[model samples]
Target: MAAVIDERPHYRPARGIHPLHAVLLAATIPLFLGGLLSDYAYYSTFDIQWSNFAAWLIAGGMVFTGLAVLSSLIDLARARGRRKQALLTFVLLLVTFALGLVNSFVHARDAYGSMPDGLILSVIVTVAAILATWVGFSSLRVGVTP
Candidate 1:
């Protein structure tokens, strides 16, 4: 038997996963934390409704972000091929942000003048989502496999 070496350079980062995963972790943690803070703020502020669409979207996005980041970790267990995990994370991240994209257009007119909070929250979460996703993309495994 002959020892065969990988002909192609592995997608290993010279710096390691810290650059991507850490940054993503950093971006999303805030939305999750802010959800709690915002809830407190709303509760303290009078005449604020908690069960509205904006509340759900923001709170849900934060939770989703936290879950996805926790789930899609690239480590020694599946380090050889973590592309699938990467893909799943990408999809969830998209879904998390798509909510924002939808709200942006829907809140444009604001006929009732009911404070387009969903739109604002959506914008913030979407930006973080997009940035985190991009960082993940950079850390993704490229090239073909047999």
Candidate 2:
């Protein structure tokens, strides 16, 4: 038996997003989810403090979402083969940020009045965050796996 060496070039696609963008984008999910849980707590317990927690969490989520949006825009412009996926991820992050802004405003109202609507917005924002994260990550891969 003769020893033989097989030579095959491995193909690796460029990363779809920068590491900082990924970190910022990943941060939004937990923050928004926290906001949602806080909203639910407020809704269930009717406590004003939970609204405050939700507001702060939403604000934090917005901060990260905004950063992610900017980074994604840069990624979109830089991307070559993955432009469409990058654009979709950017749009999703933008939508999440916008909804989070609205949710923050809703949470700013009187604790009692903010309910239902605030909770509703929280749900929407959380779902958007999840979808954005999913789409962003799912689109990162280039080829079929064995």
> TM-scores for all candidates?
0.38, 0.87
Can you list the residue pairs that collide in candidate 1? Answer: none
Model 1 spans with C-alpha error above 4 angstroms = 1-18, 47-80, 103-146
Write candidate 1's Cα lDDT for 90-133 as tens digits. Answer: 56565655654454344343333424454355556666575656
Each model's lDDT = 0.50, 0.85
Candidate 1 residue 99 Cα shift, in angstroms, is 1.7
Total backbone clashes of candidate 2, pairs 3 or more residues apart or in separate chains: 0
Best by TM-score: 2
RMSD of candidate 2 to the true fold? 4.5
| Candidate that scores best on lDDT | 2
Clash pairs (backbone) in predicted model 2: none
